[model samples]
Target: MNTDVDRVVAHLDPGPGPGMTEGAHALMREIITAEPAPAPRPARRRRPVLRLALPGVALATAAFVALSWLLPTGPGFGPGPAAALDIREENGYYVVEVKDLYAGPDRYQEQLRGVGLDVTLRLTPSTPSMVGSIFPTSPTDHRYLDEIKTIDQPGACEKMGGCPIGVKVPVGFQGPAEITLGREAAPGEEYANVTSFDALGEPMHCVAFRGRTVAEVRELLAQRGLAVHEFRDTNPYIDEEAASRTSVPDSWYVNGGYLRAPGKANLNVSEQPEESDAGGLRNCAAPQGS
Candidate 1:
């Protein structure tokens, strides 16, 4: 093998010659090398207009919100202060619906003021005819409880055929006074109501009339031509459960004895014990409404 190596190397031929000649290859290289590369472009600058526009848009939105809060809205804005209880002013008085039993004296007056009046309303159990009616009895004398009087609209109201609770006062009347209304009793509850008051806001008559017995009280009221509607003997122990369900004290029924006269709220009178021999009414005062 050593003896033939030099001879084999010298006899070997190279592969086929390159397709392009040396001169042509050199010319192509010169042409490519002669051209210069273009310069890199600077990064584009962001526009200041977008930055300025954002703050202006934000300011405009804020101004619109402020105006919305500052300006008063139209009638579509929910309701007025007394709308919760459907209270509104009609004619010269405030008209209120006896929807809730516990709307107390203060609450009633407050709602009345919403319609530019200052008055208190006492609620009472009413007969069918007396419901939704307002009486203008003297603020000084309360004897009108037995009589059925209305502020000029009973006939008109009957003709209109709608039950509406109304209050009446003198022209330009501005004073603290109490009014009465009749509310029907619920299924199991006794009817409750308020007594009429004078313009001075004084209670016309004594509400709780002390009596020896319900019979005695009945006779006394009957003698005065008062119509008795319902008689209830309340047990204080039984009322504790009911008292807890309501916000105010039970004005409809007393723990002892109860009586009702037409055009009046339910009355609470004292009854003689089962074994007592006490008899007759001395200076009995009729029970009043809250």
Candidate 2:
């Protein structure tokens, strides 16, 4: 039965129309070569009609031939490759929505390259205040830095804890730019950027330890269930070995400090009063010492 169908299909002229695609040809071959079901027992004497089945097979072949012309051929046959970044065009700018804050820099670079931008993305661990902020890392092109815009939902950073949702780059930008974005620090991980201990929402937001003795600052930290992890000197020329000492004199003055991690602080202390109070330390006028 299959041999008879094949002979009929071979004789049919599919000439003078659009050429069938490879896919359509394969489909036609499959339909012609398919096995027929076993003949059922007839109640009365009857002959099998091959002519009746030929019309239906021919119709199916014609339908598929039409469909093959519509099917896209060559390289872009199916859905394009998935992108790591969700970039869209808005107001003459390419708005890039950050889907994965923790994704590797290479994945982001590849996606940006697809959009004809030579940009490098780096995600750095930061404190709560600095999280979701974008910083330009390119030293040479200071002018182009202002063109890249950081986008954030209004009042999201302070109220909803959702900030810096994406970034906007001008269209036709041919940049060899490098940018760094802030991400939440992992457990026990130090922040890449400096976070003031007296900054709003910090552990020591209202604490007044400037010009206070090291012994006094230790007591202040002890009350708040925090400990000095290390001591840093503000002066760059200070001896590295002496500055990193585990123990310092209690009479040393506390200049400023920053939170290294949760419950751990790095105090900037110095022996001289003049040097300790050099930096602009926040003055808490209210009921002080948290």
Candidate 3:
């Protein structure tokens, strides 16, 4: 009995079109009354009568259109198939589950484009603790940064050092941004992100190598069946490429280190003691001393 329903019913022509069955008419009535009338809009020219060979299909199509018109058509409510990526709408966010982590980057871009997002995805090799984490290239852009989030399972994330299993993007995001997802590294592949040497699940976790002599750290690494691949200076101003190639004496102090590969470690060493140990040791002391 709603005014919108009355208008829709008035538009239905009972002329020389295919005859709808009694069941089809009943379904049409149910669909029309399924929701309250929507707000009135400006009048438009009437549509021409639809002449169809299939009476039931035509009536059902009309009923579906009416039902869809009554439904909300907001940002997250738009219609799209969930293929390639399992994208679901939840609380103004699109919960996206990547169907194939090993898929080429172009495949990911194509799927995201299908869902109205302008995103680029990169799957990068990572350390154990960092696997499944999400990183956005534009870290300074807070406009969309806060809306992009990682989705995780209840206990699975905790077991994996708190790494997420999925990603979430805002329904209304208009991005030209690049996103990186951490994935398990293949054998002999270096990690893309530099995790702390002592970070949970890292190869050197709990190993006290900080402020030790390079010779002493080498001995410690040898004991753990690991070897130094290269030594880098702890100074932030030093050029990394030049430092990696420069020869470092065994007496230089080891400030920090990280696993570059399965059995290879890259140490951060300096000629002078680190700032924290400036007063503790003027010279690189024996490895026995911290």
Number of the top-ranking candidate, with lDDT as the measure: 2
Judging by TM-score against the true structure, name the best candidate: 2
Clashes of each: 19, 0, 0
User: Residue-wise lDDT of candidate 1 within 1-290, one digit each (tens)?
Assistant: 01111010000001111112233223323322211111111123210110000000000122232111011111222335543234534444333443344455566555556555554555443223333333222243322221221322223322011223233343245544444443443454432321121101112223333333455444545554553443333334534223222122222322222222243322332232432223322122333431
RMSD (CA, Å), each prediction: 46.4, 31.9, 25.5
Pull out the clashing pairs in model 2. none
**Candidate 1 regions off by >4 Å?**
1-102, 127-130, 137-165, 193-290
Poorest 10 consecutive residues by lDDT, candidate 3: 51-60
| lDDT values, one for every candidate | 0.29, 0.47, 0.47
Candidate 3 achieves a global lDDT of: 0.47
Ranking by lDDT: 2, 3, 1
Q: Report the poorest 10 consecutive residues by lDDT, candidate 2.
A: 50-59
lDDT digits (tens) for residues 1-290 of candidate 3: 11122111111122212223344334334433211111111123221221111100000132232111111112343334533344557767665555455567676667677667776666554445445444343322422244566554344222112434445677777776556555565676655433444444455545667677889888988877789876667666766444553359989997766555567776768887676643322212222323
Q: Write the per-residue lDDT of candidate 2 for residues 1-290, one digit (tens) a residue.
A: 11222111111111211222333233334544422211111123221111101111000122222111011011211223554455656666765544555567677777677667777765555444445444332334332255666554344233111234455677776676666554555677654433456544345655767788889889988888789877766455766444544457899887777555567777777787654354335533353543
For residue 86, give model 3's deviation from the true position in Å: 3.9
RMSD, candidate 3, Å = 25.5
Q: List the candidate 3 regions with Cα displacement exceeding 4 Å.
A: 1-84, 88-92, 137-144, 155-162, 222-225, 234-242, 245-247, 275-290
